[model samples]
Target: MIWLRKTRLILLMLRGMLICATVFPWASVAMRERLIRNWSRKLLKLCGVEVEVQGLAPGQPAPRGAMMVANHISWLDIYVIHSWHPARFVAKSEIRSWPLVGWLCEKTGTIFIERGRKRDAHRVLHHITEVMRDGDLVCVFPEGTTTDGTEVLPFHANLMQAPVAGGLPVQPVGLRYLDAATGEPTAAPAYIGDLSLLDSLDMILRSPPIKARLVVGQMLHPMSDNRRQLAGFAREVVADLARADLVAAAASVSRAHQVEAKGADQPATV
Candidate 1:
């Protein structure tokens, strides 16, 4: 079953590549975004993940020209967000070499940054500022690394400069993966700590259905010209959202377990 799923995902990716190569060049920007959103939803369904977006009205369009900052948990994070907004992303330069995925990302306007080189970071930041200034939405995982679904790591403030420089709004997006049945944070989808992308995919396919909960926090304006302060504020909002969701999910699961226990303790009605 897992292999079948993998086969289907690969085929879909190939189809995406073909479209990107043949159609995207001529397709309007709206057409391309619609295709990306549909494709991303399909990928999530294939992986048995359901996305529930909160804090956005049904059918509401994603914010334009805002810099979206999200806490990274897995490679699937991109697809999860794209399923909802189809925003162009800023990813590591290494992903530009990731076979099919890499080419697809580049074709879709993803900005790749070489980590660790101050000059390259500045170059990418400038490019991101220009893109945002043109009224295109761009998302960056400011955590600088992926984490398990349990926590949001400290954000790297460098990318925050794009919004600060462009005088754009920064939106904090919180993502959490949960067990569909138990509502607890799930590890199956986490792509942390030495796990290859293939391994992560296999884990997700083998696990039970997963729920990707995306919380869109209120947009923050750059109060001052300080990128670090803006990054810290965004991180705080994301962290609060994540922690609140975890507590709520846990409470719901506990209530469910209590109900089951109470029913079991009673005599059978036959």
Candidate 2:
């Protein structure tokens, strides 16, 4: 059953990408956003992942020309964010070479940055500033790599320069993935370390459904002239939120176990 679902989702995703490449360019901003959100939501559903969002009030518009920094976990992080808010992402330059996925990312206005090149950072920061000035949201994972979805890695301060230069608000978002059945945090969706993409996908498909929770932290106005300070503040906000999520997940699991224990202790009804 899982294999069949995965196959069907893969085909649908391909079709969606084709439509995005051929039609999205001519679409209005609102139309493109709607399509992306719908596509992402459907993809998550197909992957048996349920999303729960908090902090950002329902129907509250995302801040204009802002930088959204989130912790990196699975490859699903992009789609997860897009499902709620479609923003241009700052990604590694190598993603531009990945097969169809790369093309889809390009069409969706992703900004590619060549890592380890100091000059490239300046170029990318300039581009990001321009995008924000245009009143479009831009997202970045400052950790520069994926994690196990339990804790946030230290954020590199360089990327914070874009928001400072652009004079845009910086928003920190926290993402946590929990096992639906157990109510405990799960690494099933994490694409960390040396795991190949195919292997990660296989693990996710074979696992039980996952609950992805996104918590939006308060917006930090770009008041500091220091990018390092900005990055540190953003990391602090994200870390606090991540800790809260883990605590909540642990409490939820404890409650579930307590309920199960009570049920087990009850005499079986004849």
Candidate 3:
């Protein structure tokens, strides 16, 4: 069954890639956003994943020209977020060579940064500022690498300078994956350490359905000239949000088990 599902998903992804490669670049902004959203949602469904969003109210508009910083996890992070809100992402330059995936990312306006190069970081920051100035949302995983969904790594402060330079609000987003049945946090989606993309995808494909919970925390208004301070505050916000969600999920699960226990202890009627 896993292989069958995987086969179907691969076929769907291939179809999506073709559309993205040949047609996405020609579409207008509105049309492109709609297509990307629909495509991402469908891909999540095919992967047997569902998303539950919190914190941001329904019908409330996301801040214009805001800089969004999220914790990095799997490659699915991009599709998961785009499934909810469309934003141009700043990804590592290594992604630019990943065959069809790389091609689609470039066409969709992703800014690739060459890691370990101070000059490249400065160049990308300038580009990010321009994109934010244009009233388009831009996202970055300031953690610089993936982690298990349980914790958020420290954010790299250099990129936070983009929001400061553009005079844009910085929004911290928290992402966590939970087991669909037990509601406990799951590490199956973490793309960390030495795991290759194919290895991570295989793990996700073989697991049962999971829930991607996104917590949109309050926007931080940069009050100081210090970029490091801004980055620290944003990281604190994301960490707090993630911790709160884990506590709530654990409480809910405990209550569920208690109710089940109480029911089991009740005597059966004659």
Candidate 4:
């Protein structure tokens, strides 16, 4: 794999510094979130990456207090999903240190958890319960880890537990990538092995626009009571999402040049 060239690497570092400076303010969580969302979307576009969303219409109004569970494919998937919807993410704690991404995550009210740490995870869960009770939206990647665009991994039960509290409904979202009808388009998906982050960044910067499909699947209401019930329900959602129309009929999910919010942006829980 080609590492980032020295000049491009310097440019990337400067971009990171700029990202931190712009988004790391004491502004209300809402304003910070919109800034991060707008920036992330811009960055991806700068990389020549175009996004598409199916299963839902653009600017289609959605109810609040909903949980979106989608298949995890790559780090870019978050941008693809978030660009389509203004929703908070449930992320692993490690991601909290990923340079510009981490800073943006903090400012945007991303619910982070210490993986495999029961106590820390519990705190996050409690926070999620509070968010659900408040009637907001949260997007979950139950596949947990990223994967190649081939198959969906078995979702961990813990990730699915967030929607259980307050009896909120879970919405399954299917994320997939395909080649253009003519030629085989390349893609960068999550696979095993600790590949250098810079490598992924450089690779994407040099590639053509990928065709993506973010299918918002049917919404499944939670089966009341805790325990494995929520996990089971999540599993069902994952199953349906895995089977949704991937590339048969492509739909676009591109955001307009700007998304003008109705009010001042302040951070709010999912």
The residue pairs in collision within model 4 are 29-266, 29-267, 30-265, 30-266, 30-267, 31-265, 31-266, 52-253, 53-253, 65-136
Error of 3 at 142 (Å): 0.8
Q: Can you tell me which runs of candidate 4 are displaced by over 4 Å? A: 1-34, 57-59, 180-186, 226-236, 239-270
- What lDDT does the true structure give each of the candidates? 0.84, 0.83, 0.81, 0.62
Alpha-carbon TM-score of each model against the true structure: 0.89, 0.88, 0.87, 0.74
| Candidate 2 Cα outliers beyond 4 Å, as residue runs | 245-270
Compared with the true structure, what per-residue lDDT tens digits does model 1 show for residues 36-146? 999999999999999988877678778989899888898999999989888889988999999899999999899998889999999998988887888888999888888
Q: Write the per-residue lDDT of candidate 4 for residues 13-79, one digit (tens) a residue.
A: 4664565566555566566556556756765566556666666656776557777777777777777
CA displacement after TM-score superposition, residue 204 of candidate 1 (Å):
0.2
Sort by lDDT, best first: what order?
1, 2, 3, 4
* 205: Cα error in model 3, Å: 1.5
The regions of model 1 sitting more than 4 angstroms off are 244-270
Candidate 3 per-residue lDDT over residues 1-270, each given as its tens digit: 778877887787788788787887688888888888888898888777899877777798766698998888888999998998889999889899997788778877899999899999999999999989988889999998899977888888989899877767887788889899988998888999999888988888888889998888777766445678678767777776665564543343344335435544667565
- Candidate closer to the true structure by lDDT (higher is better), 1 or 2: 1
Best candidate, TM-score-wise?
1
Error of 4 at 185 (Å): 6.9
Clashes of each: 0, 0, 0, 10
